[model samples]
Target: MTLRWSTLDTDAVPAWAELTNLLAKVDRTEEYYDAEDLAEELSEPGFDPELDSVAVWDGDTLVAYSQLRVSLALTYEGTARAMIGGGVHPDWRGQGIATRMFDEMEPRGRELATERHPGEPFELRASGGLEDDPARPLLSERGYEIVRYFTAMQRPLPGDPLPEVTDPRVGPVTPELAEPLRLAHNDAFASHWGSAPQEPEQWANGMEARSLRIATSRAAVADGEVLSYVITGQWVDRELYISIVGTRPSARGQGLARQVLTASLAAAAATGEYDLVELDVDSVSPTGAGRLYESVGFTPVRTTATFAKADGAS
Candidate 1:
């Protein structure tokens, strides 16, 4: 196999988009990109297209490309981790292209990330459908260990039939209550796995940057304090992604979280904004958030086993 690896340009279209479309036929269990995620990930702030990205080519044919992000992973600590992947066009599979791409990506990820966060060790993170997918096994052979399992759950919102949402305690989020919402978010997610405390300024700036479908975010407040809230992401391609939902410890038993989530989904259904609502939950969480999502019509669509690989391992 003749191979040439080059850095991916942010402005240029990535090969992963088309490769995923082809992979969809072969791997029916996995959901790669729903159009929205593809566009969003490309535009996301942490995405550095110049030094960290790579494209694989064979005789001028665009075979695959890997995208990398350098940041602190919520699931892992201290050391650096990279989220990288590339797809082989269906017609070009079974060749050494994919393997060659992976071999190049690992060292390149280390070089780029180590330069940014000096002296820290670099790590690689990969996710797979966990059901004998070729990519998963290939990664295991590359010294990556499955460290976490994530459940991608979805709730179908077409029929507009939600559980009773009249909890009286739950209502729409407002500008005045943003701070309290942040507090609630911190508290509710604190006990959950990989939860981190983020600043309110970043949170507000995030929602302000895009069409958050802001009118529908729900909150439960009592005694001038926010108890719980659920923020809804606008469905760009018929797939509504729930950005975040949380409830403080003082509010957990009140069923406020469910009410807020129900109300948010109901609103999404009403606006004809999305047909399916989706969110990911840590399977190890003690809060039973997975069950909460399931009870609200979200079924586990796929599992991505997280793998950790030390850079330049022996």
Candidate 2:
């Protein structure tokens, strides 16, 4: 079979989305995206698709792809991380297509991380849904070790009694409070595993995501400072994805995170546009975020594992 390998470009958005959604179904990942959603991602800050993305095509059909992105700042361990993401079409699997994509992605990821972080230690990270995911053996064979697990949780909307937020400071996120929310997020996640601060451009990119539902997203503010936030977005019809939930360190224990999250859920249910709300949390979160989510009626749907290979590792 003759195959064409090329860097990703704007013209490939539709084909890319088709392949991605197909893979999601085949892998039971439940993640779905429209071409427009992916187009926005291609334009994300610090991501240069021409250099950091790869697509494999047979005739006019996209069979596989890979994307690499380096963090803008070092993690708590002082290590730079390059997140590698992509998959091969189900029918095209087991043909070494994924390996070929990784051959290009892994080295490019290391180079990009080195360029961005100078002499800082670096690792390449990737994740797959469930313990039996097809990619797990491939990653393990490539010297990648499982480093973390995250659980996807979902709560049905408009059904259960939502938590109450008595603080009048909690309300829907506003355009004017975007920057403050970003600051709060960075501060809140500073100590989390493998997390790095999102620079202004990255933060703005997330805030501007096509699916972001600012009307249903909630934030808590005091003295003009954002103390906690719950940012929600939608990729599938009738399903609200809770993309971010955080409370700044200085404001933790004030129950601000729970307040904003519950308020966001209440607003979503009030809209009558959603059937469920979903979010992913670290399975062993240091902040007990999983318990908080469970308390709010979320139950685990599935768990995904992250695998990483340090630079220069055999």
Candidate 3:
């Protein structure tokens, strides 16, 4: 069979739900994502659909595709570019199309214009993940380095394990405190690498247009002030995705994050829609997040790498 790889037209790629359904088939699962979920993500500010997509064709059929995000770099390297969602259809494997797809992407990423921030350096940050399956080895051959390991951790449901707490510093979020919790959520994540400070409209616009499952959001309040939180959301398919977990600087050392996480877990378990919860943590957070997660029953499932092709540099 002859194979051809080409740039994908964001609008022409099969709908998100279709691609997701195909992915489920490749992985031996019935799980997949809906279009609205990714449309909202792509709807976010700074999302340029054209410059970030790839597709493969077999005489008139779209068989494989990829999508990536490009953002400013704030790392020691001063500049970075990121790539993700690069996958080959299960039927199309073993032909080296994925590798050629990588080779196919570099020239385009480099020639495209770069955005400059006066005080920050320019860099590339490319990331992609493969399940614990047969195709993972291509990452190394493509010059991708495994700089981070992430766990799609899960916690058993229906039995809430609320930790005993006697501190006057923690409490649940009330309607009046939602705004402050949002602010704290942003500030707490400032120190996290590759994280973008979401816009204020995120809480309302993004959530209201979609099901953010506000019922599961957890928070930690102190002296009538909201200090930190983990904005939680559940999916329609009974899978709980831990959207983001954060703790304000002033509330960092008090185990407030854990308490908030527990609260979110409890809320998720109560819904009876999910039997597990999942979140990703950097392997290198100074906060020892991975260890903290493992201590709470999260186990490592897979690891991913960040790769790059310097501007015209080998």
Best by lDDT: 2
- Between candidates 1 and 3, the one scoring higher on lDDT is 1
For candidate 1, the lDDT comes to: 0.70
Q: How well is each residue in 1-314 modelled by candidate 3, as lDDT tens digits?
A: 87665565545435445756777667533345666665665555444555666667787766777765554333333444444555667777888776676665655555342543333433333554545544446665655555555545566665446565444555555567656866776677677665655555655554554647667877777666677676666554677777777888877788877777777777777678887777777778756777777766667655554554444354
- Compute each candidate's TM-score over C-alphas: 0.78, 0.98, 0.77
lDDT (C-alpha, whole model) for all candidates: 0.70, 0.90, 0.61
What is the C-alpha lDDT profile of model 2 across 202-297, one tens digit per residue?
898888889999999999999989999999999999999999889888998988888899899999998999999999999888899999999989
Lowest lDDT sum, 10 consecutive residues, model 1, at 69-78
Per-model root-mean-square deviation over C-alphas: 3.8, 1.0, 4.0
What are the per-model numbers of colliding residue pairs? 0, 0, 12
TM-score pick, better of 1 and 2: 2
Clash pairs for candidate 2: none
Runs of candidate 2 with Cα error greater than 4 angstroms are: none
Please list the residue runs of candidate 1 whose C-alpha ends up more than 4 Å from where it truly belongs after superposition: 1-4, 14-16, 29-43, 58-61, 72-79, 111-122, 158-160, 167-169, 174-187, 194-212, 221-226, 234-236, 310-314
- Candidate 1 local lDDT, 59-167, one digit each (tens): 6566777777655333224466666765667567778776777776777777767775678766777666557677777777888888788788887867536787888
The residue ranges of model 3 lying beyond 4 angstroms of the native Cα positions read 1-16, 24-31, 59-61, 72-80, 111-113, 116-122, 128-137, 165-182, 199-211, 222-225, 305-313
